[model samples]
Target: KYRNLLLPMHMAIRCHEYLRHTAAAQITYKITRSRSIQVELGKAESFRETLKATQGPCNTSKPSMLDFVNKAKWDAWKSLGSVSQEEARQQYVDLISSLVGTEAPAVAAQPTGSTKGFQTLLVSTEDNITTIRLNRPEKKNAITVEMYNELIEALDLAGKDDSVITVITGSGDYYCSGNDLNNFTKIPEGGVEKLAKESGELLRRYVKVYIDFPKPLIGVINGPAVGVSVTLLGLFDVVYATEKATFHTPFSQLGQSPEGCSSYLFPKIMGAAKASEMLLFNKKLTAAQACEVGLVTEVFPESSFQSEVWTRLKAYAKLPRNSLALSKQLIRVVEKEKLHAVNDAEVERLVERWLSDECMQAIMSFFQAKSKL
Candidate 1:
């Protein structure tokens, strides 16, 4: 009884302070402190430290450091997902507030120098280019609901603010791997129906935003693009990559269908046969190969990729902003309704896939594979 009272009282006070100061005061702190969960937390903290250091840009060799960091982060998050979310709300409120502090730091004072409270992205504007980076390299830059909201916010800013162009990229080794499985695992008690409802709503919002983005959107594929990320490349005005970059669509592999309006876009962009190879067989495309196939605009040398890409983009951004916007709009205006319909259909099908036995089996098989069962 004392434990319950103490936690809530402490949290209420702190949360009041938090709510007063910042909006990202939302805290999700549910877990059982089992040995395995603690171990996962330790690993997650370690990866986060490394991720903090990898804020802006860093050089890389053959197998880049980002790749290593991404894998470690994925492993950590995967382990963390094993944690159950059945604890009392008051306990969580108190524990989270105590650990992370009462007041969430203001965006202007973020350690990453980002002017936003993004859990899975690093957002900043320079020379009219709003660069929204996928910050969760630990999970191969997967998209979660929070991350989706952040991305939309960034785009909204780009449309309203003085930013001339917006660029999306990933940290560590990936541009964006796809939707994070961790998001689906959070509602264990609600089962497949819960997963479908939450994910379908989030994904539909994401697809709508992507389809109707008002500003010129560029994708900087720093290393690899996979799943929804790969499909999203079809929507970007331009996609640039490094020599070490790769592209893959694993919809069928995951017992899911194409997303990001790729069901319509892929066939047109890469031809019917190649699209089948990618969607069905999970064919991975190297940077040069992706360039040849029309998915990637250019593949720069790994050493100078970042500098070259940003320099070119900054130069292009300096071009008349209205001209750039109008030109892009002209190119894509015809397909707006088509893409929207496809997005709606895909979301419907995706919900069905989520509830299907095949998807459940595939998810179970994945766990077995990870646990060596």
Candidate 2:
């Protein structure tokens, strides 16, 4: 833990403590031994206990490697290039497994199905519950233009595949870090103005898919969700989140506006003040806070989040399919007209925003910083 915890002053103290632990215990860690990050064999057998003892203040709030990685913060891409969502997710699962002293089951390829051949996502259906995982954990599951296009196809496929419900979740520790900036670097032959128009249309169409989803869309907030990814939660029928999950919409900070009809629904569900803070002031909400304010359906402990969310989803999938569909449709009936209008409005606003000097300033400033690096 000390190795990953990033402490400068504790080196010598850690060295002394490590030596003490080594004298008391038999094994120093496999590679590290600065402070004997090992448990006394007879003192604790459980992984959690051993971890707690080996790393004092095991749950410290200090900046950590895991946190930085999970948050997708990097100086540049070289050290941890552009990893696919699936790979990033596996890295997170592996990290958690290491912390708990167990090898997590690798997310294996499902037997051949419609989900096959996808590069940025994993699709599978079991017990009538179709799951669409944002599989690019390598970039913190950041959505690329291709991913957005693929998701449109995946959701449409699920709608017709006799799947009763579709569950959307991130592959690993982070739900989504939003749009991959690389998507912008590839300007089409027409230039950025043309690209901006196309981007707005692409987002507009995708948001429509969310608005008109034939089946219930459930979001499993396995970890933090950022940017446009958080905006779509408003369209989810139900949302389950782990304690570690956070919903951050930094639109104002990033020179964007709320998409996915969040501008319409967030105020209705969480009140205008909260919505303003999230959309305009750059607010971040944790799992419990999200649930209390109605952004999340339920919150579960991180240790058992996967089991808890899937168990309920599978059971829900067993209910009468038509009944679920009809129920969802009926509930959404009142919002049909409003959703369409807001989606278009958001698109118009987004197009104007892209052309605005404010947004250009933000983009230029960001790229300038990157260039300096």
Candidate 3:
């Protein structure tokens, strides 16, 4: 009888603790109504926290004030559902529109001084050029989540910075090896779908950023440009790769499809057959081969690679930045651009294939083989 009587009290205390912890966590609101509601809810939470900290165990049958507030707030929210539904939708649309209309925040504006989300990409302005470098040579400058975010963030910042006439490279040894496979295993449940969506969005944003950018986006591929690195090369206005440099896309080897609209861009740069061969066979190309395919503008000797890249960029920088940017836009004007469609189709297909038994078995087999090795 005593234990049964204590059960409700124990349950209420646990509930109180849970709600207190939940309130302590940072919350995000997507719409104006949600923000307003969250603010009100936060105030109620403060009251509940205060009560929880101060109030002694009640001997009475009456409910506590904190419990009363929680139930009241929840009931009020439920009552307002019909009234808030349309307003909530409109606020969301407005928020999205506002975001789309405003210029993206500059990398320089960030207090963190990081690009995308990487702490490794060091950004510096030299003369009229913005130099961005991947600082993680220890990992062969392999693209991690932070690195990927930083790349896009840096590009976005450069795009908005009018003083940046040309963006130059500043990484040692390797341009980028590929996406970090170790990071791949850490992805959460439904991460693949989330990544696909995010990748598509990032690709679209990058394309617009590059196309409408006031300055030339030059790429100095100092070494290997593999996976996302190679696809990103297609986004640049001009690319200079060292003789020692190589480019590759190993999507097929990983049981995934091409990304960053490589499907459309590669075929446009190289011939359709060559693009198909590279993507399907997971082929690696020398800098000279990349140049031959019209994917790269020039290949310099490894000894003078840095100097050659800067020399070409300096020549480009001598031209009015707007003129160079306009020329790039003109050159690509006739190219049948279908990046978004291709990205969506590829992602849809990839998700379907990723869920397939064949792909699962292949991935499992590869991991097993790797473990043995």
lDDT of 3 by residue, 29-84 (tens): 12222323333333433333323332323223434567985566344333332333
Taking the tens digit of each residue's C-alpha lDDT, what string does model 2 give over 282-325? Answer: 98999999999899999999999889888888899889899999
Model 2 CA deviation exceeding 4 Å by range: 1-114, 368-373
TM per model? Answer: 0.68, 0.68, 0.61
Kindly report which residue stretches of model 3 are placed more than 4 angstroms away from their true locations once superposed. Answer: 1-118, 168-170, 189-214, 333-337, 357-373
lDDT of each: 0.72, 0.75, 0.61
Per residue, candidate 1 scores C-alpha lDDT tens digits across 51-101 of: 222221222223445789656544443443322222222333444444345
Q: For each predicted model, how many residue pairs clash, with residues at least 3 apart or on different chains?
A: 2, 9, 5
RMSD of 3: 21.9
Whole-model lDDT, candidate 1? 0.72
- The most accurate candidate by TM-score is 2
